[model samples]
Target chain A: MNADFLLKIDALSVSFGGVKALENYKLSLPPSRILGIIGPNGAGKTTLFNVLTGFIRPDSGHIHFNGQEITRWEPYQIARLGISRSFQNICLFGKLSVLDNVIVSCQIHERTSFLSALSKTRAYKKNEKALREKAWKLLCVFGLEKHADRRAMTLAYGDQRRLEIARALATAPKLLIIDEPAAGMNPNETQDLLDLILKLKEKFNLTIVLIEHNMNLVMQLCEYIQVLNYGRLAAEGLPLEIQQNQEVIDAYLGDTNNAGSN
Target chain B: MNKNKHALYLMISMGLFFCAVYLLDAYGNHYYQRVSNLMMIYVILTVSLNLSNGIVGISSLGQIGFMSIGAYVSAILTLPPGLKEHWLTGLPHWMSTIQSGLFPAMILAGILAAAIAFLVGIVILRLQGVFAAVTTLGFLIIVKVVAENWMTVTRGGRGISSLPTYTNLWWTSAVAVITVYVVLRIIRSPYGRSMLAVREHDLAAQSIGINAPRIRLLAFVISAFFTAVAGALWANLIGVVSPGSFYLWLTLLIIIMMVVGGMGSVTGSVFSAIGFTILLELLRGFENKIAVYGISSIIFAIVFMLVIIFHPDGVMGDREFSWDWFKRITPLF
Candidate 1:
């Protein structure tokens, strides 16, 4: 079989003060697919994302992205290498204008240096103009062009979440990881976000790793699903297969159902 | 809106400023000339410090250390061989003979400060918040102690005096304008945006491919360069270089100027520098009349207290003063 996966993780483990947050985790992800990671709180789903994105260093592991070993790369290096992520909580540049939030992210691709900027060289002006155009186009895509001059913190909560996604996409990533994007969103907003996520993947040719608690949305969008429980993989399979898996039913849904009945 | 109109406006303003400086140089009284020089020096110092304290969001109190380094280096470099022979008698043979012009010495001083800042930032930029600030404060103390005790190099606390006083109004104003232009360019650059992003949220910035530590280090080094240049110019203007001059009192004055001017606004920094210089000069004149020695300190304390109570964000509050303000006003026919 061809090693066609865009990302492959092997034997990843991490511990905090003798409490293993993640242990012996493994994954193989192909490109341009929506992969969902689901589990109860403290089940290490976000921990895995953190390690994958370089916020946390695992005790032991190897992660290969785009066929390059990336386990030891810094967060910024990993981001530059084509991985971008949105936080579980909205983390927009709150004091900046909505347009500037996207412009700063788009700056990762800018070629001009400090000297060029200081000189106000033709190249710097052209690059800055192009970047602004690109950022405006991105705002148009997310229906945020009207709010371009407003501060990010002044945006509505749903708009803030969408803005975070827009900022992430401005990096022009090959892989986009979104953590709890729909958490504070209403059902109507979540529905729109679901459509937006699917549209972005298609439009940008992006592979997506989504961590969400909204089961219906997850089941509808993800072709593959991995369920973690207490720092271990409880089940990994097709969405339907994971839905019917006995262990997942026992560890996650079973607890929820028991609490509901109580 | 067009580039040519903008350039023309800039040229007109710059031309006006140059005319004013030439007039001052030609006919202004000694007191007024001295006041303007102090204003320009303060503008350079405060604006550079604001790059770290305001843009990069690091409250660094070690600026005096870099300033002392620049002042001493430039003074030693530019001091006449006869003067060096008269004072600082323990100096090495080559050092006693070596002398350079003020311009090269100023540049060398800035380069040395930048080099030292780069090395120091590598270790301390990793620290966050007050921990980093305290470490910098410690750095200031260490530099001061070294300047005091290193008798061979600094002439101990006796300090170097009667150096060439070559810093005229033209030099100070030109350097101040250049400093402002360079800082504004930096703020509008991508690296500057990266530094601002790091200031906003370091983790978020890093996750987006902005290296926070490197951005901070760059800002620190750039700030050190400008600050050192200001100090070199100051040393030349006063014809004196003393360890006692660049102390906590000078640091406090600069920091207060930054705060009162609006910590993050370049225009505010310039305004505050000019305003405070004039205010201090007036207060000094008043003190001389009344035989009151510490009235200026009292006034400074009162001003700080009132600003904190009424307008803690300072005058401009992170906003730039732009040509748009002028463009918005139409002349009544």
Candidate 2:
């Protein structure tokens, strides 16, 4: 019931046929804060995101966004309410041009009717021009302007990741959730992505909730952090506190350390 | 500035197309004129089907159903009241007394077909891939069965014939031009972009606020409207309406044209429809000389197999024929 919180989830639970994917998950996020959800593989990090974005219906829960209950809203409705996300796997419109990928996201806010588009009315033309310019500017931000006309699938791996983020940003979302933005990046590219995320947060005044396996990026970027283990909230605190919490380290961070050593 | 330049090029192309059609109408033999008219109708069918199957990535096998609905609706409406009363004695008083011009009948036919598509799409568009394709094929069978059994309205399998020959080269060409223009405009618009996104990845599209089901339904309904209009034109041109004509064979012909032309390319669909129609006519001539039955179908099947083997993405592969391509090739010539 906190009026200042931008997103509130309470008593959220979802289950597959016999196994729980998420159980009694809760989050209260204030505006303009970066929250990181870190967990081991199969720890339900993505399942939580799926529920929050309305891609999956919770078995039992309540979600309030901007003071409106959106527990049962459709994915597009949730997105239009100013929540946008990038996928864990790269999911660009493979056959569409790089510019077109962003333009399609920008089109969520388009006001012209199909009739106007068919007739090429002045309003439709102006709106279309504005959308194109906005998409082009976004591509420019990602250093993709040179490849705007190329199909998205033709881009190199890192560029495709950047384009996904650019496409997500084009929706003008208040809450941006990116999953594993540094998954396949080299150290140099990861550094650039870290800087880009910080810059975008400042430029758009965004509330970002990201799920990352890269601990260094998570620790540097997140103001608050939550840890999940076996579909339950294992720890929630400031980044420094979560880094030192014994249960979280034993449940998740220890695995990363062991892997690094090996 | 570039947008205006492209528009100018489109206008010039349309102008040249009409001039060519006019020359054929004035000087070509009746046989060639009729074949060209049929080609225009197939062009409309192929392009409209491409919107659903190619661009939206929804494989629909029910286009012939909508076409049949269009054909029957237009035929019943435009048939002279005296002829209707004499031929179809089971018609209701209101239906038997009504006689309309070709234009209004065709428009009504399209509207009716779109309405049916809207209802049907709500239920079936939820299915994806081959399931959706099979459901649409079932829809075609249902429509065919209804037409065959509804003796009062459709006169059953015998069909309505010889009432009028209202379709000509002008009507067919004008409608075909409008179909191409409208589909092209749609492909460049926001809605078109959404459709393409949904086709690429449904989850990604939904994440970005593109309503996947709604976008798919829009494509289906618009495609059905145009297909229905083409059906109306075909019925008027041939001066007959039969359930048998709107079945699997006709569906296969239109689908072949779409597949060979490249599913997602509008220009590909147009050229392929024209190319295939002419090829079929030439094959028919050969069939007549050899006294062979079903030889044209066999040849086309082989041609389709060859195209699939060598050029699986069709002639266009989601790319349009741009003026730049024309310029690039001019040097080689």
Candidate 3:
């Protein structure tokens, strides 16, 4: 309760083509903490992410970030307000180098002055210099300095996941939202990803939020868990409470032997 | 391996290139100067189109619409009543304050072009992918229709004439150089990257903090502005204007320039601008055929298909032919 809450959503709702995707939903999130969201396929989990991140415009709701109302602010505005995200599908620019992919985040660091742009001033060059260094450092931090100049698409699946995290981290956000970071990874890769997340959370003092179907990773990694079913907030509490919460079990994992539940 | 060294060398080469151009123009005949002038304006036009066509991945066939605004606006602003008296023969009231100078008129025309583009960009950039390109084409048709119907200003079918031609080789080349620099700087900026990301993956860019629609709109308007300036210079060069000057043929010719040079590469655009200018000159055999839009359409199709097939990367590929890249590829050459 004493933790600094970074994001708070109130009664968020959205409809896509007459299908009510998200109904009245509300949640408050704290900083420097890991929040896990789990739900069935159509339970509006991604929709919730979209609404909070400015992708989906809620019909009736408010999104507050750091105590300021950011309900209707644009995506870039929300980003510049110190929010960053990784996609469910790894979204690195396949054509560009890993270095260039991360450097694109540098665009956020400086506001791309019109005068410097039109006239090609020295300030533009200085900004590029700073960006190049920052991009390199971020890549290095992810143990990817050796592969800086390689095409992003050429990276191994695990490296690609790490690269995505690195690119997101380049935004220098106070809060980081990752969608399925451990997705499509082998056990070794998932462990590596989990370790990287821990290392990064400590290093950047980052508040992390993610959507994960990997309950093992979710329960182990997340401090707080929110479960959704049918676009409603079914449960919100610590990880153990979510584990025992019967409704969460029915929606997320369903009635089973919990084979991957180990 | 320092990229800064390459940047420094490029700066030096540009300065030298300017000096060379100054010497040649200062001493050479008018004919050579005129060829250079044509190249300069084409450079501006083609490179600007690349902003939308290449960077944003929008193939705008309506580039001529924005160009027409610049040409007509510049012509009306600069052409004296004595000169344009026949063209504006049936002028309405309260039209006497119009000036007949070149630079002021060109500047005013550029601003007006951008303002109009800004407004139109709002409606036009609302579209996406192929629909966006198609809507802009429709926009060009609308501009053409307006210019033809507004007979008092655009001279309808006969077109406006007797404009004070103030565009010289020096001015055109300088504007071309600066325009390239301006566009390059823009493409390198965050807005440019966001626009590129929108082209690459719109949903991804959006989730990562880019507002795709707004970024696309900015590129669209800026592209329109520079395209209009090129048209203004073009009007000055020809010393005449006609509603028929911009049409399907002209649009095809401009598209050919951008595509043949490589869609988004600034280097490709400049090279293709010059190459396409020269190609157009060679197509002088089809000057008569161009009136019916035949020659340009054929040329555009052939060039576009060829580039898309054999030279998908355009003339320079995606890489620029800078001193550094040149040196890197020198061994192969």
In lDDT terms, which candidate is top?
A: 2
TM-score, cand. 3: 0.89
The 10 consecutive residues of candidate 2 chain B with the worst lDDT sum are B324-333
Native contact fraction (fnat) of model 2: 0.89
For model 1 the local lDDT of residue B123 reads 94
The residue-by-residue lDDT of candidate 1 on A169-190, one tens digit each, is 9999999999999997788888
- Candidate 3 residue A238 Cα shift, in angstroms, is 3.1
- Stretches of candidate 3 above 4 Å error? A1-4, A120-123, A254-262, B1-35, B89-99, B283-303, B328-333
Top model number, DockQ: 2
lDDT of 3 by residue, A199-256 (tens): 9999999999999988889989999998888888889999999878788777676657
Better of 2 and 3 by TM-score: 2
Between candidates 1 and 2, which one is better according to lDDT? Answer: 2
Candidate 2 Cα outliers beyond 4 Å, as residue runs: A255-262, B1-9, B331-333
Q: Higher lDDT: candidate 2 or 3?
A: 2
DockQ of the candidate models in sequence: 0.80, 0.87, 0.50
| Candidate 3 accuracy as lDDT | 0.80
Please give, for residues A142-200, the per-residue lDDT of candidate 2 as tens digits: 89999999999999999999999999999999999999999988888899999999999
User: Candidate 2's error at B291, in angstroms?
Assistant: 2.3
lDDT string, candidate 3, B201-244, tens digits = 77667656677777777887788888888888889888888877
Query: Clashing residue pairs, candidate 3?
Result: none
